[model samples]
Target: MKTYNKLLLLFIFLLFCEGLQAQSKPSWIWYPGDFEVWLGNKMQSRRTERGTFLPPFWKFDSHYVLIDFHKDFDLQEAEEAELYVEGQYNVKIDGKAIFGYPNRLSIPAGKHKVSLKVFSQDKVPAIFVKGKKVVSDSTWLVTYEDKEWIDQSGKASDQSGTTWLKAAQWNFDNAATPPSAYALPTVPQSPVKTEKLGKSLLVDFGRETFGFIRLHGLKGRGEVAIYYGESPEEALSIDHGETLDRLDVQFDQKKDTLTTLTKAFRYVNVQLAPGMTVDSVSMLYEYAPVKDRGSFHCSDEEINKIYDVAKYTFHLNTREFFIDGIKRDRWIWSGDAYQSFLMNYYLLYDSPTVTRTLLALRGKDPVTSHTNTIMDYTFYWFMGIQDYYLYTGDRSFVEQFYPRMKTLMDYCLSRTNKNGMLEGLAGDWVFIDWAEGLSKQGELSFEQLLFARSLETMATSAALINHQEDAVTYGEMAKKLKSAIMAKYWNKEKQALVHSSIDGKQTDNVTRYSNMFGIFFGYFNADQQQGVKKNVLLNDKVQKITTPYMRFYELEALCALGEQSYVLKEMKAYWGGMLKEGATSFWEEYDPSKKGAEHLSMYGRPFGKSLCHAWGASPLYLLGKYYLGIKPLSPAYETWEVVPELGGLKWMEGKVPTPAGEIELYCSTKEIRVKSPVGKGTLRFKSKSLPKVKGGGGLLNKGNGNYEITIIKGKDCVVKYN
Candidate 1:
């Protein structure tokens, strides 16, 4: 009887071990390249393309120009004579031609080579001319030659040292003839009109020029087009057309040139015809680029180009067969938006960068020269550094910035009041501008809740690194603060968490932000979770729930509740909703009907708001680490824990590169597999349906160069291999 009992126990232990080995595969493979592009590709068929110059044009500092025409003539003739240029295969003047003049010449906007041929009845004389544009009564020309012309070597030359020439000298004896000079018809200037279109700012003007558009306190990317019309309404209607092929001017950074293209005009025409009165002409644009400093310089068209390249790389490498061919650096850029997107790509491909500029940024001044606060900038820096450390396991970086990180974390901790809560103005608050529940003053509860949650993340990160003492102190403080928050804000009778408390009594109002914080911070008990799930997820009063802009936080809260299936549903809906709504990237908010609405910002203009690459990227990383279950376990940085949570996903597979080594996991309907370097460690399998493992010795000894585990069952496994 005793022998039979022991054998039965051994069989039970073996079955448990097998169950623990059943790992779920990851839905997406994270690599060092841009993952957002991959996400975009999976949902869309076409990738965004890069900027390509049509020819005879030079790109410079986000602008393009033709350098040859102005270099050979003098001020008087160049200003008086009209130039007719075409981007064919070569250049011709007055039906006569010049050899070696590039037809489709592509050059950066700075100084470049211009080969000109002058043909006349007799030998033509060499001429030099000044380039100028006449605007109304004023002649707007390059006066300071030093600043106007950047030489081939990118050096500035003084205009005083240069000379101009006449059109007669260039071969035109009848310089005043009809074809010798070109004139642009003047369009009357009308009053400027401003309108709010969906979540965008539409600025209409009466005329167009090569002038600068200054955004006083704005940071975003959008299409800026010059449109013509007789009245404001007609102009707005024409500008808002879905299929209008309006002129687009793009600044090419690589060649330092500006390239402008129009549908069928020698130059972009903005004139009001005989039958038409000057109604309104303005630049209609959209702000959807990833939000970050320095990233604001690029226009929407330019950003779309970069986004396209990124998406292409992501789609090409999503399959397991192509994993080894991934190029990690193809998407790396110094720009904030590019860098943030690169970090997400790095998770899929285990690659590291030698540069630590992002790390230094976190420790330096957080204040932006613009209206954005220190916290707004610092949050991105911290997130970047944390992601770097999490993937690379580079202690050198952690050691270098640990003190500064602690300083920032300590400062956040210090902000807690006697009630263990802190309140501050929410930076980048435009994402929730449509919420009618917000008071004019501010949402105190939402502000405090975000701070508290940020602190908790910091504390938890510290604890993950084996800073037991520091973690304990921070964790304890977090718990205490959470307790105080519940006691002060939660209403047992109402079955809802109040928005805020003034002196003691709770306010009865419930907000999406407040409730999201409660679930996100784990302030709710099991019963409270049920109430929130019912009220927020299933209740008709909360029918709209929150806008797509807040989908990141919403999904995060759902994940916190271990509701993977529910979160997956929301992810699909949010992603599909944005794509169908004509989003080039994830938007700040969602509109189901495609209304020409603008996202509201506290600073007034929607362009002043951060759009694409803001805090939205946090969800991609979180989904990769938590829901996908490819998380690191040691601060020493050598090994990672392969715990798979299938989360309703079909067959999934991906690789996570860590400082220690690379670990690959794959799962299918029939079987699950985990591969890593040989090391001895215990594996824990977690599931409510699975029974606990009894005394059967947990560690697996390493023998071969590699370790492999296979199981055939459900998708829940925790392997603590060294």
Candidate 2:
């Protein structure tokens, strides 16, 4: 009898231990999107021009100052927990307040609620809870306001009006690491050489880098002024420099002082008063710790150099979010970020950055103005979502924000003209490209194409969230708009879609904007596709695209039409031109005709253009999707296709990141080798002779020298061809 009782007790204890082990891993959590908004405001406000604070012209928003977080757990046994918070906070259990900020507390078993209410003015309100069974994670709920109030009789009133969302988290898994202390990692770097003239010192960092400048052995009682520039001319012109800083320091001993803000520059012109003295100057090069998963190398050294510069340019622009540039306008623009999203999916495959940028761009919105106040940019936001879903297959993201998508679409729908088409209303910036003589008048065919695509995104999102009615409505709307685009803009004589319509008649203009998008969007039939290719795309008479922003789509259109060879040459000419001018990073705009100082000038201001822009890194996408020809046929890359097109290269090798794992490939003229960590892939290529498969089975021979072989997950496949 005694042995039996002891055995039963041991069994019960073992079961309890198993339950404790099953607890989810703890992570830092906060109100959804509150940290991102707070961080964005912090990042954007750091911009300065000639010692003058330069904030965005548009309204800058902040996160909620106060938040209440709570979670209910039914523990099998009693537990003890510790709390860490970013702001002044209070804790409660089962509606009973704890006396003070208790570092640790004990809770009894049997379904109870643990809550924390935090308030802050400058930083985001966040918390990290560590315990055995009750830990902080996304499972917890957070709200800006908890309306549970006590009546006169001390009875709680209805708390139905308060809204709660699952807590948001990133890589802040360590309890000691809070969102408020987030900063990009940095490394120490010395200047290439220094040139001193009287009280002025010109320091060159050799190449374009961004970070806080450090002053060593600084014992000064006067003012120290620093002017930063991407060009030597801009740095020397103190008054017109885009970014500068002035510091008033009074140090008793030799101590190192770091600048409060990070700036983009290759050269710094530092001037000091008589009393101010500095031994040397260095920099803390700040950067995100992202692994370069995708790579490209070919026989052409110029292409390789272009690829390297593009990668560096992308890394500089890819910080907290896909920013427009490192030098100026650090604000997130939807159109710029859309290209960044594509490039990131190909290179780093950093889904967290993608979602963060999307959510930050799509703020808690009544959809006041188009994203970045541009009509086409708003549509890019929607298209970004579609791409995010296709690449990540994160349905929860779509489900959580489906309502916001509907509201944004509704805003667009409400602004449409009486003829059921999007037209520029008052205060609407119909920015298609940054070209002279471009008109923002009447209804643009480009805007309608974007609108139709946005509707399709809404339809796809609605279906994912089980909003069947909304799905049907958006589907019908997309179909209708697409039909209208074909009927209204299709210029048979011009063999292209007209740029815009005035009053009610279509214009005679034939721009590449809508026509190029039509090719990728599949709006054009076989005949129309060929016609647009000849009339608009191939026609050099059309206004040439100046910015990489539009060049991304233009190149993509050409690649879709199997014009990879032509697109590669164009990329070489456009992106290569910037490289020849000693560009360490790709520029916001590169005009081959512009010479020396002319190349640096833009927007009517000297050195107005950004040296490193996210959109300038489109070759990452073009090379990955077109040349490597690896894309997901299904969401999350469950089933994908690899159709390697050399695009006029002797051989090309690269990796494409997927949700599950990476797909690796190496291709030459006579042999091809490919391997994937996940997904059922189809490897297709064109060869004049029969291709033999090794380490795999079954090759499908499509007529006319096209062949395909099935690639299963976790297997290496090689093919030999003539």
Candidate 3:
């Protein structure tokens, strides 16, 4: 039955691809990771602080200035192909160079090799080739250094050193829009209301947003100052803010102009100079082109509202690459992006975006400082890739990037001390959370836990790629590390994994970081699980997690431990706390103790906190995976399960994306509905009585009032568990 299903799905997919191919044309392609790297630079370089150009302080890498792209094609008949190149490029056919910069070329019948050598310093070297049958796509191979040496006799040297990768391409099908001309889609948006406060027009856009401010009908020769804010207070404050723009307007006619950089703000304070006048302000709302593939709607209004705002927050942060936030430090942070990747699995399920973001974060590997200069963040990068593979079942992605993974893992392994533990060396940021007075000293238990998980990821990836010895090595290393962590960090009195060990001795400090992770990572046994939950997770004395970054794992651990009902209240109190504060989007951190504009402060500055941070969207994952309870048991959803938990909701329904299709589920007190387009699934639930399918068979009883039923693809199942 599975074989037949696979074959049928393949047939349907082929038909769909045929339809798409008929409409679409060839797109530009480049060296596999170069495009993403270049694009990351472009996006990150656009970040401005107080209208001054601000770039990343870390070592930012660049794309290859030179690249060679080539593809061999066999045509039964002669054909003409049009070519578009981004930089100073030379086209070649059959290894012989063609004339200067030809837009069109003729290919003779039979097998032939078409190639282009391009040099671009400012942008990625890319090309778009289109024809009736021959076109540019992933089948083409690209290399950064094409060291092909030919002697006088026209004999070439061994091309061993020249590494060729499958070319990467996105939705750049048009001839006019090459890869270098890529930009996010934008839509014009007007302010909800505007008030003239003396010289400045205080414009309210109603909610948190990211866009380029446009000045309409401008005829001035003075500067226009645009102050942005997530709240009205931030925009109103002129000198004290995170992002603001001052534009010099020299327009003579009644024309319109837009601010050069896109900023995050709902409120814009347009302060014009004395001579600058006669215009209203609007914005071009810039955003990614991702479509919503998964959804969640629950019985609770606040939960629904929280879910909506989380979704919007994630959408705002999902640009060229998943960024930390939009307003400040609009750069990719691995830890922030890891959460975004998980959220994306439930919301967008955009596999390309996942791969693109991963590539960008990985960058060009020379094993620089830990990802984002934070130790835990580097581990998150590996875990992110592993999760991507599990969610999408795209082994080729793992297989392609395993070398980089190995190199990164090697860098990590080399840093371990004599006791097989990691302590923050000079220049390495421990960065467990944003909590105050958190210890960066000593061999941290949280880092060890993440390192063990990262090793496990390496083991899994290595095994997938059939590297048996390396897999065993990584597996053993992970096993040993877990043991080491347990020996060093576990405290019987504390009844939890202590926060860190000070010089080989466990500290009395009991934090939720390692303990919460231990529960979900399956590192803790049953008794230990109960101990940690009681002593640390629920204990009032334990330091609380204020950042949404740590709250994500905290909540996930609770959900995994079957405490969703309790977690529901926590979610309401935490996320719902932000919603009640008139938040249009989720925030970087939310402390109930902080009142009014106090919520806007962080990092020693007002508005230093990002209002729509990517990590703030954990509910998307929690609701879709935990509440809807649709998750893959095998890679790519070949086998999956639905273990829906209402979590205090009377009824909750949602769609979860799988590799092949979606799992649609509706769960309530009396009835349950499930329909899936891919994979075989087991629907598990509990009731006081026996349950029967609407069509026929009774559910299988697993004792203790538990019931389950097998769910096959393309079958709409309705169960009455009365």
Which 10-residue window of candidate 3 scores lowest in summed lDDT? Answer: 690-699
lDDT (Cα atoms) of all candidates against the true structure: 0.38, 0.88, 0.88
Ranking of all candidate structures by their lDDT, best first: 3, 2, 1
Per-residue alpha-carbon lDDT of model 1 for 1-722, expressed as tens digits?
Answer: 99999999999997676454322111111111112222222212211111222221111111011222222211111222223222222333322345564323222233333323323221111223212321111111111112235568665443455422211111122323222232212222232555545432355542221111222222222343433221233234443311122223232221111222211010122322222222233222211122111110112232223333323223222221112111111121222322333334334332222222342233222322211233323343444544555555555545434555677666555545566665443443222224655542322566555455555556656765667787777667667766666777777775667666766667666656667657855667889987877776445566254444355556667676677767655655555554444333343345454443443121353222222323233344444544445554443334345445556665456544444444456543333445544232223334323222222233333344233333212233333322
Across 4-41, the per-residue lDDT of candidate 2 in tens digits comes to 99999999999888776556678889888777778877
| Model 3: residue 42 alpha-carbon error in angstroms | 1.2
Off by over 4 Å in 3: 1-25, 151-153, 695-698
TM-score of each: 0.45, 0.95, 0.95
Candidate 3 per-residue lDDT over residues 1-722, each given as its tens digit: 99999999999998787567544469988887888888887888888878789988667788999898888887767989888888999887887889888999899989998888899999999998888657888888988876888868886443667788898888888889998888888999999999999998999999999989888898878887888998989999988878888877888788888877789999988887787785788999999999999999989998999899999999999998899898877998899989999999999999878888888888877987888788999999999988998898999888888998999888888888999888888779888899988887888889999999999999999999999999999999999999989988898887889888886788877788989999989999999999998998888789999999999999999899889999899999999999999989889899999999999999889878888899999999999989999888888888888999998899999999887777899999888999988877889889888777863134688999998888867888898885
Residue runs of model 1 more than 4 Å from their true location after superposition:
1-371, 374-391, 406-420, 425-434, 439-445, 453-476, 494-496, 514-528, 537-540, 543-549, 582-584, 595-619, 636-649, 660-662, 677-722
RMSD of 2: 3.0
RMSD over all Cα atoms, model 3 = 4.1
Each prediction's RMSD over C-alphas, in Å, is 23.0, 3.0, 4.1
* Comparing 1 and 2 on TM-score, the stronger one: 2
Residue pairs with backbone atoms closer than 3 Å in model 3 (clashes): none
Error of 2 at 149 (Å): 6.3
Between candidates 1 and 3, name the one with more favorable lDDT: 3
